[model samples]
Target: MKKKDNVDLLLIEEMREEEPSWTDYDMDETSVKVQLTDTVFDMLLNDTISSLRRIETRLT
Candidate 1:
């Protein structure tokens, strides 16, 4: 077994940040925003996997 850092818990907190807050908007604005949002979401997913892997490795 290995040690883990608790700070990963904070980094895992999506709601703690303001950028991801849900909002109501016009479709035209939303359409443009969606592209940028998708890229951000993809990056988040990539980061989440790495964070999870680090924690998982620490448990083994």
Candidate 2:
């Protein structure tokens, strides 16, 4: 597997391990929303990078 895939897998594993804590009663909805937004943003960023890589590969 590629280094990027390995990194993403590690991130996913870590997120799964820590996900429960983010839902604790003391945490507010706004915090959860922010986290979700951040996750979406990261996903979009990765998608953009992957798309660019694909385009570059095709061009080459």
Best by lDDT: 2
lDDT of each: 0.78, 0.94
Show the colliding residue pairs in model 2. Answer: none
Stretches of candidate 2 off by over 4 Å are 1-27
In candidate 2, position 24 carries an lDDT of: 74
lDDT of 1 by residue, 1-60 (tens): 123455666566654574545554577698989999999999999999999999999999
Candidate 1 — which residues are off by over 4 angstroms? 1-30
Q: After superposition, how far is residue 27 of candidate 1 from its true place, in Å?
A: 7.9
Instruction: List, residue by residue over 1-60, the lDDT tens digit for candidate 2.
Output: 699999999999999999989877665877889999999999999999999999999999
Pairs clashing in candidate 1?
A: none
Worst 10 residues of 1 by lDDT: 1-10
Number of backbone collisions per candidate, in order? 0, 0
- lDDT score at residue 59, model 1, on the 0-100 scale: 100
